[model samples]
Target: MDIHFIKENIPLYVEAAGLTVRIALIGILCAFLVGLFCSMIRYLKVPILKGMVQGYIELSRNTPLLIQLYFLYFGLPKIGILFSSEQCAIIGLAFQGGSYMAEAFRSGLESVSKVQKDTGLSLGMTEKQVLQYVVLPQAISTSVPVFCANVIFLIKETSVFSAVALADLMFVTKDLIGIYYKTDEALWMLVIAYLLLLLPISILSSVLERKVRYAGFGNTSTVSGK
Candidate 1:
């Protein structure tokens, strides 16, 4: 199965895999931050902000990621918003992942009991203080597994960056296949690269889920009351 070609191209594969991981890592981090802010906005029920966040989540979730990438990479430059291919790819991935993450965290926030909010208020805490000190922490713990799974999905989705010639793992794999005509080997390497990136994330998510469950964070009975 073109073992010789695979051996010869090891360095290329490694470099491509590194780039893929780097892009995914950056995108996931950005997504998490953006998503957290968006979720908070939704939770606060701000007069205008909730609608904006909902629109953003709906727009991003409904569109094809490829179209989003093309718009970022091709369309933005016309308006003088210049970005490199890699930057465009990262932005697109972050925005896409952020939409999903917002929903995940929103669900977590919803799962938080009204009693917890009342408890914070009974302690003379402001709404902001209650959200920051009580709701967010509980929501974060509850959402850990979903966040991890979403991040893993983001890693896989980064393959789409190849379409923009971002020189990520999938891009390099395609180039290798074209050069060596070893489609099977190229695909196998791609699969292995994905496994390397995602397996640990999956395992970590499972561990975190078990920990959260055992810690009683997942139990409705643990919620505080005023």
Candidate 2:
């Protein structure tokens, strides 16, 4: 373990980590929007869109993120479509994360009782209003823990960004190992960098989950509609 090498390379890893986090944050935000849209389509049972969303979720979830990034970064350029390495990284992360986010959101949506929607409707709320005011709020509250988990998962997935030529933390670590042969030091730094990135999010997720559970958002029983 070369303490001198690790100290000198700290800035390099910091820069790489920053890039990794930025790309992951953007990708996760896009994924949440995509997931929300797809889940809403599924929940509403939209005719053609429901099937399309299901297929997309199946395809995205089943495929590896590396394959997705390869297609975006390498394959697309061959066909006249082009994306920078960063763009490909972001898109691939979002594409992979969206399906999982959709499932999490759909699970939350389904946990809201049909009777809850009906009760809101009975109160003279329109279907839209019922969904907006009654269902979505509770659904989102119920989904918070899952959302936190997904955020962490998506962030970790950024490790694969190296495949597309992004200078993420993993990329820096691998590069250093290849060039300097300081595998142990580079790996230690990688582990420490990832721990710095993930531990807070993990702890925060637990805190959020406990808070959500204590609030009893989705834990109550409701009468089943015949």
Candidate 3:
């Protein structure tokens, strides 16, 4: 192991790590927004819209992300919808993550009691208002831990972006290995970088899950009082 070379390359690794974090953050944010909207369609139970959202989720989930990336980067350009490699990477990650997130949110929403919706309706709330004010808050709370897990997975999945020559952590690591022929060190660094990112998320998810549980208990108590 070339400790001196590894020390010399610290700045390069930092730059690559930053790019990886940026891409993952942007992709995860887009996925969360899109996924939340898709979950709402399922919650509303609108016939046509629900079907459309289901189709999107199924298609995105069933496909390999590599193929998705290729389609976005190569196929789209042929049809005049051009995108940069970074954009394609982010879009691919977002779509992939969004599909799973939709399922996670759907499961969370389904877990909420139907009585809650009924009570909202009885209180003169519109369907949309009920969903917005009552159901979604609880559903989101229940879903946060699962969504956090998805975020961790999505962070790891950013490695695939290297296929398109994006300068993310894995891509730069591969370049370094090729240049210096230190494959073992490069691989270990990649593993450590992923662990550093993912471990904190796992701990955060556990904490958030406990907080949500306590909040739910508090809400129940308040409702009983009134």
Candidate 4:
């Protein structure tokens, strides 16, 4: 309950929080790209690719994220594909989030009517153009809430990177507790920092969900809210 201790360690928390946000943002962006690619492959039903994408989605969905992180951080070195702890943390978080994102996005894509696709074709648009112009926009607008939810989950999961000494907020909080022997102060600061970090994201998610639904893209339950 020492307010002084928490105040003194404010700079450390700020730095740690910055690192955490950086990692989480990078992971979120990468996961979205990965998810988009996965959804496209499955939607297109390319001969060999659809099967591979399905297997990847299933495997990632079923596995523990910790094991996935361990595989990237530890197992890669044995194959000479070395990565630092932070790098592995980013990659693993992105990969683990991507599977869930894939399913969400794929469902969004499919929710767009067959009539929409047919209309795009009747307008003399190429298949690629139809997807780019019609399908992806609606799909993304529809999937925003789910994507935001997954981003929040990914941010929380970044705490696991502490096990690899990635120096994120949770890692720095642990360090503060050990160094100062002030568990209450450090934990309080940790909780506050996370609250500050997550609050705006939650607010924006709600706002965006309403906007997207009102825009006539995501009102259906196919794009379920969290």
RMSD to native for every prediction?
Answer: 3.5, 3.3, 4.4, 1.6
Question: How would the candidate models be sorted by lDDT, starting from the highest?
Answer: 2, 4, 1, 3
Q: How accurate locally, in lDDT, is each candidate? A: 0.83, 0.88, 0.82, 0.85
List model 4 lDDT by residue over 6-79, tens digit each: 77889999999999998888888898889988998988888898898889899998998888888887888899
Give the Cα error of residue 31 in candidate 3, in Å.
Answer: 0.5
Per-residue CA lDDT of candidate 3, range 101-213, in tens? 98878867876788899999999999889988888887777676678778878887888888887877788788988997889878777777777877888888778867776
lDDT of 1 at 123: 99
Q: Provide the clashing-pair count of each candidate structure.
A: 0, 0, 0, 0
Q: Which model, 2 or 3, shows the larger TM-score?
A: 2
Clashes of 1: 0
Q: Which is superior by TM-score, 1 or 2?
A: 2
Candidate 2 per-residue C-alpha lDDT over 164-187 given as tens digits, one digit per residue, 9 for 90 to 100: 888889889989999999999999
TM-score of each: 0.92, 0.94, 0.91, 0.94
- What's the true lDDT of residue 52 in model 4? 88
Q: Is candidate 2 or candidate 3 better by lDDT?
A: 2
